[model samples]
Target chain A: MQKVFEKPQALSDTPFAYCPGCLHSVVHRMIAEVIDELGVLDRTIGICPVGCSVFMYEYMECDMIEAAHGRAPAVATGVKRMLPDSVVFTYQGDGDLASIGTAEIVHAAARGEKISVIFINNGTYGMTGGQMAPTTLIGQKSSTCPGGRDAAAAGYPIRVCEMLATLDGPSYITRVAPVDPVGLTKTKMAIKKAFRNQVDGKGFSLVEVLSNCPTQWKMTPVESLSWIDENVVPYFQPGVFADR
Target chain B: MTTKKILMKGNEAVVRGAIAAGCRGFFGYPITPQNEVPEYMSVLMPQAGGVFLQAESEVAAINMVYGAASTGARVMTSSSSPGISLKQEGISYIAACELPAVIVNVQRGGPGLGNIAPGQADYFQAVKGGGHGDYKLLTLAPWSVSECFYLTALAFDLADRYRNPAMVLSDAIVGQMIEPVELPDKIEVNIPPKPWATTGRKGRGKNVINSLWISPDQMEEVNRRLQAKYTLAMEREVRYQELAVEDADLVLVAYGSVARICRTAVDLARSERLSVGLFRPIGLFPFPTLPIQWLAECGKRFLVVEMSHGQMVEDVRLAVNGRAEVIFYGRSGGVVPTPTEILDRIRKTYGRSAGVSHYRLNPGPEARR
Candidate 1:
């Protein structure tokens, strides 16, 4: 008997504090695996966002900095600029990246900062207990949008990958999901490619992972997976949004 | 090392000084008065093997400085009055994280976007608290182009030395005016290694984490330690230049470009047989209050000349402690008082042998409330 799947070397032994059936653990594993496989864990610096994963610095085996809400990119920009020879990446949630930190991420990418960004878009603010996120679907109901997101008032969901792809400075921009086995595998590939782009000095790269928030979505882990498969995937339509 | 005496604007001298000190990254947005600082860096940084970015906004520029500074690199950013206000939050965070970086403020008249003239209205904001939380920045106010170059280099040195943010506070006049500066011979100062930098947690040592933790005990400890560091900084870094104070009836206290004008005013007043001296504070924070107090004990009447409505006057009053009658003359909203104007005020107040007038000094909007 051999180990079919084991934790990546880049992750610590600390148990995750995420809710049961939350997909953040899986996403973290994927990033860790990529870092381990690339053998860049020693030279990689991670910037954690002020969301549920704010304590990610405790779990990630690499050097990490917990940034103020929506300031992970700016913090990452600082780390990258100071340590240009090192690989730098920021792990941010939709609320942190698209809402408050919008300017930071856009300018960093536009400047073609030679770093990677792992943007987790879960349609709702999971950390603050299911608040409506900038990427929330039109009809989605969260704590903030109790009556469902009204398109007339709240506007449609932001397609961040597409929006960032339009910027000339970014070397790569891709959208993926962890809703199903196929989607999860593709999301890992995208994450790996983002890191690879940085290693190759290809400039700014991003992989927006459509993650599951079973606790926030008011569904079991199994039901949340099904909801993502039926509803979220159709609207998001995951694929590579840009490449250079 | 090539050293040349050149007449250059204070803003341009700051840029050259940064480059000479081996600064390789500059991120700033354009603002009145101080626009030349970034413009000069844009043209010269790349030529000197550095990166110069014209950021979209002051906020973005400060964040960029945060980014570059985190890498344990010497980085800088500059702005005018209102723009510097916009950068306060980022500066606070930089201080919280104890990141070493330099910020230049070529102040203009303002509570908000005032004028493009020289003003020291931000004295309280710079020396007291410009950002959130209880923190202090190492602020140096330069009075001449040569001082601009010298202090900019000193700012980087002090920042790196203490692993804290340092500021070079200038005014539009000092930034814009051209003066002969004999560039100092570039000395090889050893920059302390930043083992705490987030370069990576490789085979060298454990990963370094820079964060302002939100725990009660942790926050208290952080604040206590910061207070201690500030105390040490105050004892070690207090700087000022006193002129003709050994025998004088009246002493004029000023800083930045206004101090230069006060120097000229003092020269003219001396010619008119007025026993007036000058006290110029180079470092605004950890202010040179001891010297002012010393002059006050000598029974010198103090007059504070400023571009703002007596902002620095409060400090002078506090230092004097009623030993000498402190008076003030100021013009806010981007107005620079001519040397003759300052001289006239000096004559009207002290030349009549009445000693000093005890007219109530308006506390301005900030102090009034």
Candidate 2:
């Protein structure tokens, strides 16, 4: 019998504690699938950040190091240098990667560190209560910004893919979302490509995933996907910003 | 190759010692007094086929060290007062994760962005664990240029032995001073494999190195394990040098460069027929407390001389445990106490009428005649 699909061997048997409608689980599955496809699960090491997916190590069947908030890239940089032949990657959120860790991410990218970066941009701080993150939209409401994110006060959202694309260090930079089934397929392809680039000795590959936070967004799981397709896809303009 | 003596500065010797100790990674930022450390590493690391990175900031540098050490690599970082303060966060994180690494703090006067000159003010920061949390660094204080070379290597050993951060606490005086060091042509450092290191699981099970203990009971257990290791260190790692303490009635307790100055004062006091000796502590954290307590029980009075405003004096007093009188004399804000001034203070401790300090006891260049 041809088994069309099964759980990825790279994913551990531990169940995820993520909230309902959270796309982090999907992203995690995609990463696990990518690792299995590459048959490099044993040779891969992961750096987890201080975010909703901080416990990503609990689900990944590989060597993992939990980095201090916003420090996954720097930690990954260290691991990659120490074990150059091993595949190194970082799992980070918008708050961890775009806000507090801006310097680490920017410099790691600029240094052309040979590591893969999986950046989850959900527009709001998830681990801590929903706060206005650097990617929060102008009219988006968060716990910290009661009156919705004011462009005049909070400034505009950061387009990390476009911003990081300017740096010549990174060989591959793309923006993807899994708001729907078709989008999920695209996001998986982007994540797999990023991993393959590292295996091929390509320096600094990042895939910014526009994830959904249904609970924080005060929307149904179904509505969240619809919101992402209408609002996020327009603002973020998902596609590869750089590749070579 | 045979070991031979070579003239070198304390800062340069520290790099040489690290190289000889089989260090493979160095991430550091530039700060005064310790700039030579990074500058030397920049040239030495590449030559030695190691990694040397001048990180963007001290915080970044320490984090990089944390990263490298997580992979079971022998890595280090060196900085001064202000820079070390910035590294406190990463230091705390590393301690929590139980990663082994060496951190060198070349002492400089500070409260803010203080001057680059030497100071003994960092004694409390080094020994008492400058960073936040229930952690302690196996702090080693070096008094001479040669010790600056040797102790840096010892620091790496202590770090890996207990899987905790080891600090080599030096001052600007020792870091800048030039002296002869015995160098070995090649060193074969034998260490056990880091079973916890995340160097790709391969055939082995996945390794997850972390310090985020969310549960109360689990956190307590983690802390208990750390305390047990610290207890083991205290029992075996306390190192100090006692000079002429068998018959001496007065003992001067000091560390780092201050101990060297106190040694000179001890000689001057002895020349003046005063009974003064020196107790130089090498391990500042596991602090030779029992020896000082023994001296206190022997009815020996202590005078703690420091370049800070009575920082280590409290520790000496606590160790003395009210057995004898413990007095403190210090000069803060980068001011170094002369041997004559220290001798004067010693004479005053014995209830003798001593001449004024700062007045040259010898009519030499500092006579101001």
lDDT of 2 by residue, A1-244 (tens): 9999899988999999999989999999989999999989988999999988989999999899999898888888878887889899899999999999998899999999999999999899987889999999889999999899999898999999999999999999999978878888899999999999999999999999998899888899899889988998899988999898
Under CAPRI classification, how is model 2 graded?
high
Worst 10 residues of 2 chain B by lDDT: B360-369
lDDT of 1 by residue, A97-142 (tens): 9998898889888989888999998898887889999999988999
Best model per TM-score: 2
Model 2 segments beyond 4 Å from truth? B1-3, B352-369
What are the fnat scores of the candidates, in the order listed? 0.68, 0.77
Q: How far off is model 1, as Cα RMSD?
A: 4.6
Question: Model 1: per-residue lDDT, tens digit, B1-369?
Answer: 556777899999999888877788998998889988888998999898887888768887887787778777888999988999989988887888888999999998887768887788888888886899999999999998988898999999989987888999999888999998788657566678988877787666546455557698998887888788888888899999999877877898999888888999999978866778899888888888888888889888988998888888998999898888898999888888888888888877653444334322322212222
Top candidate by DockQ = 2
- With a 3 Å backbone cut-off (N, CA, C), the pairs that clash in candidate 2 are none
Chain A vs native chain A, TM-score per candidate: 0.96, 0.98
